[model samples]
Target: MIRTLYIDEMNTLHVCDSPYDIEVTPKWLWVDMSEPTKEENLLLSQFFHFHPLSIEDATTVKQRPKYKEYDDYLFFVFHAIDLRTMKPEEIDIFINSTLIVTYHKEASEEVDKVWHTMLNKKPNEKVTTNEVMYKTLDAIVDNYFPFVYDLEDKVFSFEDRHSVDISTENLIDETFDLREDLLLIRRTVLPMRDLVYRLLEGKVLALSKKQKIFLHHINDHLIKQVEMIESSREMTADIRDNYISLNSFRMNNIMKILTIYSVIFMPLTLIAGIYGMNFDVMPELHWKYGYLAVWIVMIAITVGMIGYFRIKKWF
Candidate 1:
């Protein structure tokens, strides 16, 4: 769907379905496109005379996070997490001195929010398209920090209270999940830092002094988040290695104990097997004391083997 927000020279705000509804050209106009149809996109080209390449890129809908400065306007692609499913959502923006256009395949709550906030300003207060772009960018950038910090918190918590039973399989599974989330975040945030930096060093719009300062701070925050994500990935790898080593040690100890028991029973099993032979003339079987003697021999052998193992410090 296509929607419009037009603020005229008298500092009045008009939300309209079409630009033709307004009698006078707006001083500041923002056209928002959501889940745009092919026909809707073609209308954009006719209305704005945007670079064909830019329009194609918008419709293709597989843009990476980037900022491209065109002859007449600046184009940017941003990624935000969808609140409902926690997946990446894209917002493409085009900004000129007096007009701003935003396109996305899905409805963005963030974009709607910035629009309302700006509309709430006093009616007599003048607004510019650059101001809208700055506000919208700020809103989208700010939206990221909460989710990043939450992920950071979860990672720290995982580090702090290490699970008691750190089985290798379970630890590996959990670490992989966390790593995947961080990777998603890193892909979006890192490019955003670069985009902000390029905007700061602009051939695009001449940012107001205030906007310049704001962009610098956003860039700083983004860089910090990238570092945090990198650290979290490293921590996951460490946890995985620790779990693997511990599990291997546990398995070795179990095997050692079983081997010791088997060794200790070897002679006893031989003695029992010899007496069980079905020879009618087995002399030792005929003696009543022979069973008692066999018990004493087996007990002595078991104790001796255990003592020898202890002296060698093999347990």
Candidate 2:
């Protein structure tokens, strides 16, 4: 679907569902091509001097987060995350002086946000394409905040509740999952920060001073998000390490008790071995009370070793 919004020089708002129905004027314009068909792609290609590679990138799904500068326009592939599943969503944009176009495979709340803003925003005298582009990217970044905070909350909750009487295996599994999510979010955010940096340094779009400052502010926010994600990742790592260490400690205790049992039984087993040897000349074998005496000695050895272990607190 193609949706076009045109703001006249007087900042009048005009909304059109069909791009052909709306006539382009000499004013700042924002064109949104959502889940565009082949015809829509060709139409957008005609409207702007979009390089073939840029057009392909725009149409392509699952593109990595990146920014490409062309002779006439700046192209961006940005990723947003799903809070529920922690998957990445790609949003592609083409920005130039007079127009801005966004393409996505699925319907995006992020694009709708910018659309609503451009429609509802009261531009007093004039609105520039840079402003619209900034709004577009800014909305995408804004949507990221919720997912970031949700991830942080989950990590923090896991950290606080890890000591609860839950299954240690489950704890480890959850922490690993959270780490994967943090890594995924980081993958999206860091590149977006780089994209913003490239935008700030590049000559395309001709960002005005006001627009640059606005973008810088957004860039700073992205940096903070990256930091939060890193911190969450560390938390997950710490949880995993703690779980491993605890298991190792438990295993050591088990081995210690087993070793103590072996040490206590060695002498008793040796005594029994001597008595069990079949020799007709053995004096103990001939004694009538020899069997009773051997039983008594084994009993005493077992009791003595158990008492010793208790005293030493070997457990």
Candidate 3:
């Protein structure tokens, strides 16, 4: 999908036609492309001087989050958090002086919301391309915080409910999944954090002082976000380790119980096996009172073993 927005006199208008031309001078142009066709790729290359490698990277799905500074434009590849599934989606951005282009593998609701907000501005309002970009980037980054907090809440809930009788497998798997999400977020956010730092340092010739300050603000937010993500990753790892230890302890306990039961039954099994053997010298077997005497002896032995086990607290 491709959507274009051309801003004139601060009133935003959507341009629908492919290869659309605007007669009025556009202070800024925003192009959003998701799974772009060959034609669209060619159009971007021709109009924006986008590097072939950058275009290739944009089309390739699930590339690691990174940034590439071209001679004419800056390319940013990052992940946008999907709130519904708590997964990360790839978002690529290419920015030049007059135009800003975004490439994505799938639709992003957060990106859409930022686009709408920018489009609704009234005429005569002064909006820079940088400001729009800032808002768009910030919106994407901001959405992750709530998702991170939600993950923390989930961990707390699990701890509260299952602290005593927790399923080790389930707890460990959940923690690992959370760790994976945080790792993904870290890969996506850290590079962009560095990119924002560069922008603030005035490395981009297209940025103004005001724009740099705005980028710094965005960068600060990203820094805090990165810290939070790192912390979450560590926390999940700790939780996973704790669950593993708990599982080991539980297994040892079950083994001990089984061992005690086997020990208590060993003598009884031996006695039964010895008396079952038939022999000519077995005088007790021939006596009528022998059966009652053996029964009394076996009962006494069983009761004695039970008392011993209880005193030892083996159960």
Candidate 4:
């Protein structure tokens, strides 16, 4: 669907269903296309005369976070993340001195919020394309905090031995999954950081002094996000290594016990083997007290070895 927000010279706000509904030249105009149909997509080329490449990029989803300078307007591609799935939703923006256009394949809470704020502005309160862009970008970046904070909390929980009650295998699996989520968030954040930094450089977009400050604030947020993600990823690695080491330690203890038992049985097995041999080794078998004597010797050997192992604390 296509929607338009137009502000007049008197600082009046007008919301329209289509661009054609705006009869007068707007001081500031914003057009939003959400899940646009093929016919609505053509508005970019036929009505607004956007470059075909820019149009294609806007229509397409999953474009990396970036911006391109055009002769008349600056084009930007940004990602709005789904916190639950850690998936990115693309929001494409076209902005000039007076007009801003936003396109997305799905509904955008960020866009909707700024859109409503613009609509509800008090009388004589002027809204500019720059303000709208900043607000939208701010909202997008702000949404990232909850997910990152949640990831950090989970990592902390993993580090606390008393907090995590699951098996080592399951804990490791969860840590790996958290790492993957951080990677996903990183992919979205790093490009966004670069995009905001470039915007701050002002080589393309001619930002005013105040605008630069606001954009710089957003850049700061992106930097904070990047740091948090990196720290969380490292924590996940530590958690995984700790669990693996614990598993190895447990396995070594088990193998030690099995080896001690094997050593204790080795001599007994040898004596039994000799006595079970045929005629040539059968002198003890014919002795009147031979069975009892052999039993005594075997018991003594077993007891003595056990005592030696206990003294050495081998168990």
Write model 4 residue lDDT over 149-256, tens digit each, in one string.
998998888757626575887888888888998998999999999989877875776677898889989999999999999999988887788889988999999999
Query: How do the predictions measure up, each by TM-score?
Result: 0.83, 0.88, 0.74, 0.91
- Ten contiguous residues minimizing lDDT sum, candidate 2: 18-27
RMSD of candidate 4 to the truth, in angstroms, is: 2.2
User: What is candidate 3's lDDT per residue for 55-172, written digit by digit as tens?
Assistant: 8888765676667788878787777877777667888888876778887877887678878887777765766656666787788878877876776676666657565754677777
Question: lDDT per residue, candidate 1, 184-270, as tens digits?
Answer: 878888877788888888666677788788778778777887888788878877877877788889999999999999999999999
Extract clashing residue pairs from model 4. Answer: none
Which scores greater on TM-score, model 1 or model 3? 1
After superposition on all CA atoms, what RMSD does each candidate show versus the true structure? 3.3, 2.6, 4.2, 2.2
Task: Report how far residue 94 has shifted in candidate 2, in Å.
Answer: 1.0
Q: By summed lDDT, which 10 consecutive residues of candidate 4 come out lowest?
A: 157-166
Question: Positional deviation of 211 in candidate 1, in angstroms?
Answer: 1.8
> Which scores higher on lDDT, 3 or 4?
4
- Arrange candidates, best lDDT first: 4, 1, 2, 3
lDDT of each: 0.82, 0.80, 0.75, 0.89
Candidate 3 total steric clashes: 0
Q: What is the lDDT of residue 229 in candidate 1?
A: 79
lDDT of 2 by residue, 82-158 (tens): 55666778888887777778888778877787677667776565666677667767877877888889888987787
Return whichever of 2 and 3 wins on TM-score: 2
Q: So what's the TM-score on candidate 4?
A: 0.91
The lDDT, on a scale of 0 to 1, for candidate 2 is 0.80
